[model samples]
Target: MAAVLLIESAMKFAIAVFSAAHAPSSRRALLFAQAALAGGHEIVRLFFYQDGVYNASDAVVTPQDETDLPKQWRTFITEQNLDGVVCIAAALRRGVLNTEEAGRYQRDAVAVSAPWELSGLGQLHDAVQDADRLICFGGA
Candidate 1:
């Protein structure tokens, strides 16, 4: 008699985006993330750093013909229940703020939404450590 063993292939992936929200790199990163989710991979964390922090800004406006990548990302992450983290330091430097951050900085308005949270660099480190694969998308 032969016994069959079933193996689960789902992998935990941590993604980091370092490009501006309007940059091609950012779009590519979103595509990659979509594909990863479609392929049944788990996204442990989606880290927005450097100019990528702009992706979390709620004030972004694009031309009618252009894709609203940040909006798309917001919908996607919200639907998937994925952890979308914007680096606190980077986001602050770029002026992308959530309600708490806006109040802390004494800003009159907040730019980031509820689905995305502002976090420290330690979150990124923990994601890298816990994920089976760490995928970074952006240009230097």
Candidate 2:
């Protein structure tokens, strides 16, 4: 029916990330992502640029009760099949890439995840291009 179709259509939405790995911002984003997935809305893509790449790190040894920003994002994206991409330029600039990047650059202890790919500005541009609407949060 038309009503069902309209409801289904309303479920698809996009969200962007440019926030640091802080409790409030990260927790807010996790809640939003969870809501979108529960509502049957497509995340479209989560672009982690600037300080936001920390949200995609694989080894954040925070307390159990503390907000696990990386795990929350990883789990939500994997569970919901969201496209999560981390900007390579920003990741490197801000120290969030993986062992490969660390070895390549002779750095130490990179902390990114394989589920979240390293990307460039073009990827973000493309994501925004395909999304019905682009919504960015925590970008200064």
Candidate 3:
């Protein structure tokens, strides 16, 4: 007889990626997120910091032959009903702003879209406290 081990509890994961959208690390992070979701793990939060904030920018345009990582992230997060947060400070510094943020800073336009919101570092701290596992990608 074959024995099957079943997990009674779902694992909660928090992902933090600090790489630019075009960097290999960013793609790896996305793949990890997808895998986690596929494996029935819950993604409590997806935090983007430093150059990773660029992943939330609506202004990102990829070459015809290249993959549009930002768009892929947006679609995945949206479809999975995941919380995607971009560090406000890092985003502002990098010119990636949501509508409210643009209004707050008096910017001409909003660069970020749905499924990805601008928030403070406190969100990351909260996710760390709540999640069973915190996976970080790329260097600071």
Candidate 4:
């Protein structure tokens, strides 16, 4: 029989990855998130950089019967109480920023959210340094 511990106090996990587009990988990333929670480990932070930043866009409208990426991300973060930060430098170059960034750059009609804050690449280093285990999925 497989032993399943019911509680954990020291596990810290951080997920840093590229955009979870297309099949297989995207599905696996989501499944992995669920598995991490079930194993009594904590998801410390989830950072999406480069193309990965697109995963946090609020205006990603999929076809009918398609997965709503932003909603799924918000639900996971909200339920797990995890920090989800989309790298601001990456987002800015890719054109995904918050209200403050828009004002700073003097632009309009940006597609981002408060749930996913625009931060610098340094945040990733901070998260990785703080987490016990950091898993990176996908590529730039």
Which residue ranges in model 3 land beyond 4 Å of their true spot?
1-6
**Global Cα RMSD, each model:** 3.2, 2.1, 2.0, 2.5
For model 3, how does the per-residue alpha-carbon lDDT over 14-103 read when each residue is reduced to its tens digit? 999999989999999999999987776789999999999998888989998999999999999999889999999999998998889889
Candidate 3: what lDDT? 0.91
Q: For candidate 4, which ten residues in a row score worst on lDDT?
A: 1-10
Ranked by TM-score, the better of candidates 1 and 2 is 1
lDDT of 4: 0.77
Off by over 4 Å in 2: 1-8
Between prediction 3 and prediction 4, which has the larger lDDT?
Answer: 3
Pairs in steric clash, model 3: none
In candidate 2, list every pair of residues with a backbone clash.
11-41
- Score residue 114 of candidate 2 by CA lDDT: 64
Q: Write the per-residue lDDT of candidate 1 for residues 1-140, one digit (tens) a residue.
A: 11222126778999999998899999999999999888777899999999999988888998899999989999999999999999999988888989898898899878898799999999999999999999998948
lDDT of 1: 0.90
In model 1, which runs have C-alpha deviations exceeding 4 angstroms? Answer: 1-7
Q: What is the C-alpha lDDT of each candidate?
A: 0.90, 0.77, 0.91, 0.77
| Candidates, ranked, lDDT | 3, 1, 4, 2
Off by over 4 Å in 4: 1-10, 20-24
